[model samples]
Target chain A: MSWITDEMRGIVGKVMREAVSHPIALSDIRKWAMAVYWPEPLPRQYWDEDYAAQFGGIVAPEDFNPFAWMAAKPTPDDPPVSMSAFRESELGVETPDYKAILLTEIRARHGAPMRPGDVIRCVWKISDYMEREGRMGLMLYTTLS
Target chain B: MGDPRTLAVGDEIPAFSREGTVHHWNRFAAVNYEFAGHHWDDDVARHEGFPAPFAMAPLLHAYLHAMLRQWAGPSARIAAVGIRLRSPFLKGCSMTAGGRITAVRTKAGETVAELELWMDDDTGARLSTGTATVAFPS
Candidate 1:
């Protein structure tokens, strides 16, 4: 039997959650660059506005993630749910008891670069799923976008 | 850095290396809001069947981006990046990420390059494989 139930598969292509971020701060971008490139001098474009004057005054890295700790749209009071699980109960189905979840893959597409004071929004959905046989057992890979 | 004009299929980009440590992971966790015990606690990792706490997946993804931006330069656009994790990047291991150009072409008047990407630790374990597309201005 497949690990994904019919109902679980039904939820695919449905929006799981949405969030709007607080304005992106230059500090947020700088700190992120510092953390990711620890011990290495960061590229001048990230922290040195003088050097980045050509990029229209310091654009955030293409991979920079804006929504980290919190979001403006989903305030702290919002019902907290494991986005990975997305509460199978919501589908009126039994939540599968799983040992773990691994972020097996990541795909990011960049548009115009984000800058200081830019507010970003994200909508997540269960894009697809498949099963694979691995060292431990049959693992289910779920795609979220 | 190779000139974007001279870039061609089969060109290997510079690699980015980092020692897998909680000091780095902790900072990334702080910024990304990733606080899973399996990432910072060896006991938790062992409980989860890993020899030591491992690096976060998103960090590995970001490392690839860092490598790309370094090669393509600031003005270049990182059109898209996709990665597949094969093994965990365990703590104390140093991993290096590198990319090789698979295709180079002109799209919409911009120079576009597609690359195959990979990351391996000091132990030679391949942690992840990926693909990326970068577009440079005409």
Candidate 2:
């Protein structure tokens, strides 16, 4: 049986959620670098401003996620956005039930570096969907970007 | 390995490794704000049919980027990174991420190196594999 539904396919390119982050902070970058490289000293560019000055200034680790927590667009007063994806209900589409959701892959493309005082805006959408047979059973994977 | 400008295909770059411990995962959760129960609670994990709580997928992806940054130096631009998770890096395991140069070419004013990346746990299981591109100024 196919997991893909007409509604799910129709909203593939539509925006499901959008968020704008508050200005990024230096501590935010420092703490992220520290967390990613715990027990070891991170590169100076991530922690020390003077050392980072050689490259311009401090920049967040390229893989940093700005939408990890709260966002300005989806104000704190607004209902929470579930961490899990495939919630087409939010976009007025019904979703098929599944036992568990697993993140199978991640692809990131970088252009400009994220630095302190930078405000970031994110638009979340369901880019694609596919089903594969696995050990558990028929698994449906949704690609959100 | 001195200037990144002389990088050649088949060169294995430095790696970033870390044990699967809450000591480190908690820190990542703090910054990333990922408080998913399955990541730290064995019971929650078992309920999901996993052997044990495992490392978050994003953290594994970040480790690959961390390895790239270590080798590319502060100035090199990491153009892109893509990873496919094959197995969970369960708690108590050790993950080491490394990559080898696959292709190198010049673009505009930068030299970009394409790499084949892999993450293997100490248990000899390949946890994830993917590719990346890092560009260094010429």
Candidate 3:
């Protein structure tokens, strides 16, 4: 039996196409942290440059915008049935553009990862969007489901 | 005392590691929605020619994040982190979580630090590698 189901696939497709945004907050970050199988007591150092470079940089929370982030990208013509498609298509929705609707509860674990037959529901809401001014510019606050 | 806060590049961070068993795989499978019948079902995974049920890449990212967060402290915010899955983490296999500081800089008046990270098998085979950036309280 597969873990990813048709209905869930449709839901993922629908979520990807929607023009929505949420504000990023420190608390929201914690919630995401708690949702995962985190080890007790974190390390005492940051991830080196090679790892850090993957994130690129933080998107200004105040300047956060998704439409501009997607910018003329084509929506998935079909529901993604494979992880590669999901990453190449939907995940790219935030690629390059750091601004994204942060999904706090989405956690992956060691296993066959989701299979084709699994069906599940994901509930998310707009968390916060704070405005901050810094020497660089205005920071936008936005998080997503 | 000398600066307890000054961390030079190349300083090693406290590392932690763990191994996943079929139980861990099963637990992960229950929550994940992308498994295609091969995970936790040896018949399925074997029939599909998979050595064993493999861990999800994003989950690997989560584990790495957990390692960094534990180091940064409770109040620290994760500004950004990224990881690339290089090898598979099979059921009943162990992997180590470790990182080292590579650079430190200032941006927007905040001290930003960078780290190099790796998750390896018991033999020290690299499964995933990447970096994390965080801002600590000044």
Candidate 4:
């Protein structure tokens, strides 16, 4: 039986949205910077009053955009398959048939710089699905926003 | 950061390498709120078929970004970035992140450069591949 069934194909175009309950905090940016070893002088730009003043105030790293949404705690009303849930599923053992799901690719475009106190929002969609033969076996690729 | 005008398509960017540490991973997990067993709990990771706790994919992506941002300089604007994860970067593995300038051109009155980036373990095996575009002052 093909894993890429019509039922699975039907998931294409499905969308989920989420909003950060609070503004992006300076502490959150600092923590992420330190975690990734984002150089010293640059980390200062995220918190230091002097360094950040150059950027019009503390500037969040460009890549930190996605993490802003990740740091947001989910609300009871949020969709079950929201961005947070999708990430948790990728790192958790929730795949169908107990098969492993690997992240093959990721693409992101930077829009606005999220400074301290900026509220964040995220919208993700199931863009496409395909099946292909792989070294391990049949592989199902799902593209999400 | 090097002068963007002087950079050519074949030049190799300065390499950035780091030794993965459990302490660093722990700090990363705490910050990301990622308590996945495979990232911290060795027993669970082994049960899941990994030789040891593996680094999170985002962390590896962050490493590649750091490499790019450092090379691109503070004033340069990163327009886009993409990565393909080839294999898991296990905890405590030493990896180097580097890239080569693939193309350079002027866009919208600004100089832009495209780069092919990659991460390789100490054994020289590629763990991930990536591409990035950055715009600099012409």
Q: Which prediction has more favorable TM-score, 1 or 3? A: 1
Model 2 scores what on Cα lDDT? 0.86
Every candidate's CA RMSD: 1.9, 1.6, 16.0, 3.5
Report the lDDT tens digits of candidate 1 across residue range B45-132. 8877789999998889988988998888888889899999999999989999999999989988799999999999999999999999
Cα error, candidate 2, residue B10 (Å): 0.5
Q: Which pairs clash in the backbone of model 4?
A: none
Q: Give each model a TM-score.
A: 0.93, 0.95, 0.52, 0.86
DockQ of prediction 2: 0.79
iRMS per model, in Å, is 1.5, 1.2, 13.9, 2.6
Q: Compose the digit string of candidate 3's lDDT tens values, residues A6-99.
A: 3333334234433322333333223233334433321212223244334442212211112221222232343332322123144333322222
Off by over 4 Å in 4: A38-42, A65-95, A133-136
**Per-residue lDDT of candidate 1, residues A1-145 (tens digit):** 6789988888888877788889999999999998888878778899898989986788887777787887786776774653223555644567677666678888888888899999998887778878988866888887877
Best by lDDT: 2
Q: Calculate DockQ per candidate and list them.
A: 0.74, 0.79, 0.05, 0.56
Q: Which residue segments of model 2 deviate by more than 4 Å?
A: A83-86
The 10 consecutive residues of candidate 2 chain A with the worst lDDT sum are A77-86
**Per-residue lDDT of B23-126 in model 4, one digit per residue for the tens?**
76876677666666787788987776778887777777777777877788666778888889887777778888889989999988788989998988887789
Task: Name the better of 2 and 4 by DockQ.
Answer: 2
What is the lDDT, from 0 to 100, of the residue A134 in candidate 2?
A: 85
TM-score of candidate 4 versus the correct structure, residues matched by position: 0.86
